[model samples]
Target: MGIGEHVGRNLVTKSKWTSVANVQYRTRRAGQPFPTAGQLSTRLITEAKRTAERSWLGEVSAVVLQQSLRDAETAYRTFFASLKGTRKGPKLGAPRFKSRKDARQSIRFTANARWNITGSGRLNLPKIGAVKVKWSRALPTAPTSVTVIKDAAGRFFASFVIDTDPAADATRMPETHCTIGIDLGLTHFAVLSTGEKIDSPRFLRRAERKLKKAQRERPASRRDRRTGPRPA
Candidate 1:
């Protein structure tokens, strides 16, 4: 999901004639082993429309568009850094030109408000955009970082990281527990192991005829203004 979103957003930027980053992932063939990064890079450059290029940062840029390539790289780096391990991944590669059909959309800032929290209630983000947050339970310690993301659905969501103490359950189990078995049959809704039976209301069966009649009737339509039909 993460890599796909990055590619999709970059594709959008290329549509605006801005720069973009060319990126590729490695996959294994049916009977072949997974390809190495070098092999993937070679394939991408060979098949790409433009010659493979590199930014000052030194990465394959053959098929990348540049509008938000830098920003996307930054976001990707930030994302991996937040992961549990593998913090020292390769630096972001340079951007390259996109094919004519691949270039068509650009990124625009829409009116979206997102929030994040460091811990239980302390909000944190870049540029000191701190605010208060509400949590159902308190955190044990402060969070390492927080990020806010907005989606095309026009909804805003926040992701928070926090260190906390593990919760301990103090409830005791009861010794005198009773178990009951229930059997369901067509004649009775439920029959208990103690010989008790419960009847079924079968509401839908009782109202079947009325419901079918209502569904069969055609609903009245509004009068047509152009045709001068009178309202019923």
Candidate 2:
């Protein structure tokens, strides 16, 4: 996991540098500096290796670094599409540098990566040996790719995409005649199209006074911890 973190950090850092460089290059040219993802693949790979070879980054899996470049390309493509109004929904911000202090980190492993699940219920990853897996539920089918994630709570999870049969999915949810829309709001948990309203949980509102009282007494509690009780 440590090595994976190092790899992901370098990948994000290098990708951001390339994005900045691409912007600078565009300024010099007639707003047509670099080519699309396909044309720029070679250059990106060369630059990535050049940057990696200088430090501990060279130890990272080459395949993972390539995936990072692909992710960066996708980010740029999405940003451009949003700017041109080709994409739906709100406009997206340009790709920004990723920080280590961030709550989560993830790395993906494709088929090219020699990763698999062993009979012993362990995940066999490239470079990183077999790791025990805590099964929540068994996978229905083989996954095309797997993403290892480390969340803010310092827990690791492996998420994967699998192909499921449409018929099976349909069977799981029987068709219902009634249909309704819902509007979620702070005042009410949900307002249904059928005129039904679900009240919002007032737990926090009810406990506000107690919370404030606890906050007000917190300093005195700390003082009591530091000093002995006052004389009667």
Candidate 3:
């Protein structure tokens, strides 16, 4: 989890630097001065190497660090593409710097990181040592990559991306004749094609107090418009 925090911080720093550089380039009256992602990564990697030797970042896997930089590049690319109207999706928000107090943090490890699950079900992370993991289910095959995550509640999770056979997946689900489409609603949570209406649960109203408290505690900048005062 500490490693994840370190990586997350590095990503935010890199993004801020990129945004600043781009703004300066746009304001410059000289010849074309555009800072590309490759240029940014090259400089970032060099700086990271120098700093890594002296700080806790030295303990983080080099592969994981590079992956974080790649994730940042991807974010910038998507942001620019959205602005240009080339990307098909909801408007992408400019990548914001992450805070240490943020509720979630994550880092990815590729095959090069040499991570694996031990016979005892412990996850072997390079530099971080072996961590005991609770298996929800057995992985069908070895995963190509794994993302370690720490959530708001301070619980850690390892998400694995495994390549599976499509034929096996098809066989597992089998052909089903009883297929139904669901129309979702507020009062009736879901109305099935067979005319069965599942009523919305009362638990939402019961949990309103806790939800309201959580929203109230959130930073102003992070709070959405939905948290505002209700209509008269």
Candidate 4:
């Protein structure tokens, strides 16, 4: 299945949890004993599996659905904590429902999901096939899990949680009292305290010049216009 479908299934699962929370709140307000968090959590999972138009849930790993629900549970827990003035920082409103129209979408896969990199370097996801990846850099250690994220700008990224040994890191790190000051400016990229000058990258200016040159070479779109129909 496509990434979009995976995200859509997650959103549907998230919405279901929100609806269940609202229902439970209403029951409590009506002077009836609402099901406890544990009860609702278990029941909701079963309900979500049998929910119509949600067979796609079975196609994806159960972790995705569970994480989305856990997210909702955490939101509500935080909201209640805020009301009681137990949660630090500013007060928070109740959790909002997830919408398909939202530009950003994400799904995380923990170690339990068994997602990993193949010998050929393709990302192998559960249910989702191996996807060709353009790795930015080499990983220092094996990632515990990966979160596939699509941002509002339509950019896709795979974020990883890498657990490294603190002792190893300390051994690798060298102790030094040396310090350097950097001054950033528009004219020059940076000036170091050691009197080193670095020229500005001017990346944007270079791209703009190339774009203008291409525009000059290409013919205008207006030239292809029919202009009230051609000569048959």
Q: Name the lDDT value of residue 36 in candidate 3.
A: 59
In candidate 2, which residue ranges exceed 4 Å CA deviation?
1-29, 35-55, 168-232
lDDT of prediction 3: 0.74
The TM-score obtained by model 2 is: 0.65
Global lDDT scores for all candidate models: 0.43, 0.71, 0.74, 0.80
Q: 28-144 in candidate 2: lDDT tens per residue?
A: 457655445544545655455576444444556556666766676777778778988999999998777666667877777898987899998888877677888899999988888
Residues 1-232 of candidate 3 have per-residue lDDT tens digits of 4555555655554555566556744675676555555565556554555774435445567677677667766776788789889999899887776666778778788999899888898998887778888889999878999998888767889999999998887887869888899999988999999999998888768678788999899877765568667444
TM-score of 1: 0.25
- Let me know the TM-score candidate 3 reaches against the reference structure: 0.69
Each candidate structure's TM-score, on Cα atoms with residue i matched to residue i, is 0.25, 0.65, 0.69, 0.74
Over 106-220, each residue of candidate 1 has an lDDT whose tens digit, in order, gives: 3221112233455455654322245455555654454454344444433334454665444422233444578889999989999999999999879778678777786667454
Per-residue lDDT, model 1, residue 209, is 78
**Which segments of model 4 are wrong by more than 4 Å?**
29-41, 181-232
For model 4, what is the error of residue 58's alpha carbon versus the real structure, in angstroms, after optimal superposition? Answer: 1.1
**Candidate 3 wrong stretches, greater than 4 Å:** 1-42, 51-55, 89-93, 187-189, 195-232
- Displacement of residue 58 (Cα, Å) in model 3 is 1.7
- lDDT score of model 1? 0.43
Can you write out model 4's per-residue Cα lDDT over 61-143, one digit (the tens) per residue? 78777777777888887887898899999999988889888888899898998888999988998888897888999888999
